[model samples]
Target chain A: MKLPKKVKINEVVLRDGLQLEAKILTLDEKKKIFDQLVKAAVQTIEFGSFVHPKLVPQMANSGELVELISENPNDVKLIALIPNLKGAKNAREKGVKNLNFVFSASDTHNEQNVQKSTKDSLSELKEILSYCKEQDICLSVSIATTFGCPFEGEVKKERIYWILEQLTSLDLETITLADTTGMANPQQVYDLITELTNKFPHQLFNLHFHNTRGMGLANMMAAMQAGVTSFDASLGGLGGCPFAPGATGNICTEDVVHMLHSMGIETDLSLDELLIASKTLQQLVGHETPSYVLKAGPYDRKYSIPTKK
Target chain B: MKLPKKVKINEVVLRDGLQLEAKILTLDEKKKIFDQLVKAAVQTIEFGSFVHPKLVPQMANSGELVELISENPNDVKLIALIPNLKGAKNAREKGVKNLNFVFSASDTHNEQNVQKSTKDSLSELKEILSYCKEQDICLSVSIATTFGCPFEGEVKKERIYWILEQLTSLDLETITLADTTGMANPQQVYDLITELTNKFPHQLFNLHFHNTRGMGLANMMAAMQAGVTSFDASLGGLGGCPFAPGATGNICTEDVVHMLHSMGIETDLSLDELLIASKTLQQLVGHETPSYVLKAGPYDRKYSIPTKK
Candidate 1:
């Protein structure tokens, strides 16, 4: 039940949430949500992506948002998602202080998702990490489809380790093992986290989960047992796997925060403030979000209006 | 996972599911579901409750169903629910060889549920266990609202132990901790089961989970780690608390079997066969069931019809 002194939650609303929406959120709306999120005690946030705007139009305003996060960099850590060397260079030129790069370990998914072989991605990662070190910018590599691949049935644990070894050799301590397709049951979560943490005890392992099979929070509990501290969650359960199959949404930040704070886990996140931000995001997108606690309210909130049957 | 060599899945369709039905299930229809459940390899079945017929007409057919199960005594084990001394005696007179008697541990729930205080129910349990011992009948006590109570909120872990201690003193070897309203989360499940198993290592423990907030299977896994092997599940997620506030359905047997079997955990029950019985029960009741796995099929089931948008 011991959580870190201050666990950093990397909010992925702007990039992941907006990309999944049919209606693209305006730059002003995204700014408002990000601004509210920072006010709610979130120190670090993944503001946007460096993907091709043609592939994901929702990320067309990445440069504008990154500039905004940098201006108010007093207490906030800003990060951007990079798909390849092209994305990494684009983010570095924008004076990005922190970057998150993703590559799938499942060779089938590595070919299908980013159209690059795993070995090629490793070479590209080595090149990018050298530049990232020169620029003194923090780097984290997310090994996506780490749990199970839609095309390939099971992603071996050893493959995940080799990918981590390549990344960790570059001296970046932070890494995320994402259940991109939501195939992680608690057993898988326990086994993988246990293996990685035991091998690389000094590295700060972060977990990113999706709730497609309704095991999002369950997987988190397993990760916590393995001493994982930081996690990634999208506001309003807004992310989906556009390429991988059956990933409905990322774990709702508000729900996980609520559960953690209520259980004496010391998340240091404001439940009421998080709820307000989630509802605002829902309204900004002009659609109901999948966050249950946001819609249902906390246990003490007596303002739950009785529904008219 | 090491499961029992010959596990008995006690189907709760007739007793648990129809309790909350707006329209009662007839004896003939309930018997048909029971027959189908047996065909599904459910070797043990909780037929019905021997409560006041005026209070619950849905389970008035307990006597008849007991008679039906008795005819195939070698093929299956039949259990009847007894709420009080009157119900216990009535079920006993019907020649039921096995019985499950439930009483709430939370004082507030005990008052609201059975109109008796927790101590009063404990007194009554002593009376009933002695009666059953005299008749050479098997008995297991279940503590309703063991996870949390609607009126009492969080029931203490000590309360569960005290009750189990009392039941053991009455020479009852088997008891179940029923998550009556599904407030049982994984941490709570782990804590309570560990405490119970540590205190009474040799006593047979069982879990009764509700899928209300969608943690039924996760809680089951936690309990399994805590050394719980036996469990109770109803077909199609049929039951709810009569006095409990905003309670959802029981843990669906088809769904539970599917999850257990998929994890290489042997349940000694066929998931596909349980699903067929669940579908038949759903049709017999002429309503949509609460089980998603039954309608959506198992995780790897091909040819799934897309859910309506």
Candidate 2:
């Protein structure tokens, strides 16, 4: 029955949403969605990716996205997802303030997902952290598939802690755990968040949840109870897990903001602008996006008669 | 990392699903879905209701559906929901062996939902239980809104226990905790299930989950870890909160079955048949169902190559 204090919503629709869709958005479409996201007042946004544009052509215009986002830096943090040192350098050159390097704790998962072993990924991470420090940029080491993987069920908790222990030593800006495949249940999420937070009291942590198993928002709730403040979500529940096989949808940014804000949690986001962003994103994708709050139009939608009507 | 030994999948789609939709299903469609569900090897199916069908016309075919299911009951148990003594008497007359009665643990919720206070509902339940015993029918007392309520926000653990304590004294055959509005997180689910299982060692209990807040399956997993064996799910995720606003979708039976079976948990139902039933239900509803498994297909589908050569 205890209520959580604060929640920060990090919109990832631009990164994860476009990653899965067959419909790749143009630079203008991406800009419109990003503009709407800023208007929505989401504190942090996964503005673009630093991975090979050849593999993910949708993000070919990453440099341009950073340029447009910089026009109004007003308090909103624009984050970029970088898989390695090369990606980190590219992001830094674009003047991206926050750099998120993605890694996998499970060896089998790491090899299949990013085509590198966990050790090799860690070595790359070590290379990236120093450059980020030199640039005075915030570094958040994102551990993907921290829960069970679709290919490899039941990811051991010890393996995750070992990676986290390394991240702690690096003394980066933040650490984030991602249920990349949506295989996480609430207990695993709670256990991981609580254990990590307890061990690293001074460290900053973030949660990235996916709605593939329909536990995305619930997993977020468990993490919030365990004292997490920041989160990564996609507008209109964009994004599907690349390694998750059958999974779909990231945690919907508008849905998270709606729930958190209504519960008296300070998210610093506007619901109307969130919905507008979702609508614009939906048009870019050429299909209805996965956000419930945006599509359903809030609690009073059914009962609310328009003033004009 | 030890998997569960077995899982019980009870399809609440017929009664729970149709009631949540804006339009009503014809009696003929209900009969067809019921027949498919029975063939799906669902050991138990919540087929219909014996309430004032006028309030929920989607269940108007309940009487007819119950009669049809009775003609070929076989070993599969057919359950019917009864709200009060009148409904209980009607269900008994119709030859339903498994009768379920839901009552709210919160006094305000009980009053708002059913136009009766908790005490009045309990008084009515005593009559229903007495009648169920005389007819040699198995009875289950379900406490709804056990985790959180829309009207009152968070529901206390002690309130849930008090309701269980009262029901235990009534000599009911079974009991269950319903996350009726999808307000339950894993810790809450685990804590309540563990406490109840310990206190009532001799009695059996089940967990009912909703996907409104998207934690349905995760909470179910936490409950399973806590030693709960039975669950209530709707095929194709066809359900929502009746009393509480902003709720959406019951826990999809196909997703739950897929997760459990892949983990090597036995459910005695055919996965393919379950999907077929879900698809059929979706077709009748004229929409893409809420179940991710139905849309995403099995894990193997992710690996399948698109054929065009």
Candidate 3:
């Protein structure tokens, strides 16, 4: 039950949340959500991904979105998801200061996601790292399918350890172990995170979890218990695994913040403002989002007493 | 990270899950669901409640449903929810062996639910206790809104401790602290349960949580860390708080069992069969359930890899 007094929430609604959305949000819509997030005091935001427009048409405006918001007065860290060296170059050209390089730990998933093997992805990470250093950009690496793969079932601890061994030497800002398809249980999250933190005490780690199987918040609790203080969450619980169609995406940003604040753990994010953003996103998506706090409201919310007949 | 080796799940879908539903299931439908639960090796089932038929039309057939399922050959513990001595008498007359008396810890909630104050409800519980003893029926008690109340924001820890003090002297089978509105956070659950368990070392306790704000499983984990080994869950995540419209009900039974099993904590319940029951319940309710496992399947399930073009 020991928890950190405060935690960092890296908002990923713009990237992971909107990637699987059908209706491509206009740049104005994306900026509206971004402004709401900033108003909620979200310090870190993954604005969007610098992937091919044909492959993921929803994120086609990542470059323009970054260029539009990079001049904000707030001390917010704006991040862009980069899948390869070309994506990295595109993000840098857009004046994006922070980049998250994602490659699945599972070779099959890595191949499917980026058309490259895990080994090839790692080899490419080196190039991305040197490029980031030369360009004075902050880079973080997210190893997707770190818990289990949709195609490969369980991703072994050894595989994660080896992947860490490769990236631990790099001058990366953080390493995120992602439950790409929401296949992680709490015990697995706790055990793996504990071992990883102990093995790489100097390496700052973040966790990205999906609520696909409804273990998202529980896994976050386990990760927190294992000393992880930073996480990635999507507003309105948007995004989905292509493999698990109809499953929920990342844990809802407002729900996560609500839970943390309720547990007396501070995230410095406003639940009310997050809810506003969540509502806006839901409207933009033109569908009901799987956000619990949005529907149920916060726990401390008081309802008028019913009159006895 | 110290979880119990095994946990007991008390299935409460029949009463708590159905009480709020718009559809009033017939006795035959209840029996079908009961059969499925029994097939899934569920040892404990809250068959139905003995509340006024006009109050909860969905549970109007509780008497007939209990009578039809009580003759089953399985070693299942069938329990019924009773609000007062009258309900208790009705359940006993229907040949129910176990009765659960529920009263809210919040005076406003208790008054609204049963037209009585907290003290009056406790007094009535004494009458029900004597009646159960006279009839040789096992009795348990559930204190609703043990964490917080919709009408009364936060129910103090002292209030819960006071309620426990009043009930500790009674010959109850087990005492359940219910988060009726799903307001209890993990730290609060851990702190309160730890203190209560330490104070009442001889008492057996169960926790009932709703996924109202989506912290149900995380709260369960925290309770387990505090040494609680039994919980109440609903099939297909079926119930909802009357106060919070559209909020999810109790944690899904299959999802809970799936998580426990994944963590290597044995529950002795067949997950596949539970899913079958969940599916049947969904069809009977004529709506998609809030069950994550039913939609996404289990984590161990491997998806067929798509062939490259």
RMSD of each: 4.9, 5.3, 1.0
Query: What docking grade does candidate 3 earn?
Result: high
lDDT, residue B230, candidate 1 = 85
In model 3, residue pairs whose N, Cα or C atoms come closer than 3 Å (at least 3 residues apart or on different chains), thus clashing, are B239-B249
Question: Candidate 2's residue-wise lDDT over A155-188, tens digit each?
Answer: 7887877887778878777688888777765656
To one decimal, what is the Cα RMSD in angstroms of model 2 from the true structure? Answer: 5.3
Over B15-92, each residue of candidate 1 has an lDDT whose tens digit, in order, gives: 877888878877778878877787777877888898888878888888977776678634688888888888888988
Tens-digit lDDT track of model 1 for A254-273: 87786566455666677788
Candidate 3 chain B: 10-residue stretch with minimal lDDT = B66-75
**All candidates' TM-scores?**
0.83, 0.78, 0.99
Give chain B TM-scores in order: 0.92, 0.93, 0.99
Best by lDDT: 3
Q: Score the docking of each candidate (DockQ).
A: 0.16, 0.18, 0.85
Please estimate how well model 2 matches the true structure, expressed as its whole-model Cα lDDT.
0.77
- State the interface C-alpha RMSD of candidate 2: 6.3
Candidate 1, which segments miss by more than 4 Å at Cα?
A1-8, A28-36, A57-74, A89-96, A131-136, A236-248, A278-309, B1-18, B21-40, B52-74, B89-96, B133-136, B211-215, B234-248, B251-255, B275-309
Tens-digit per-residue lDDT, B126-166, candidate 3? 98998889999999999999999998899998998888999
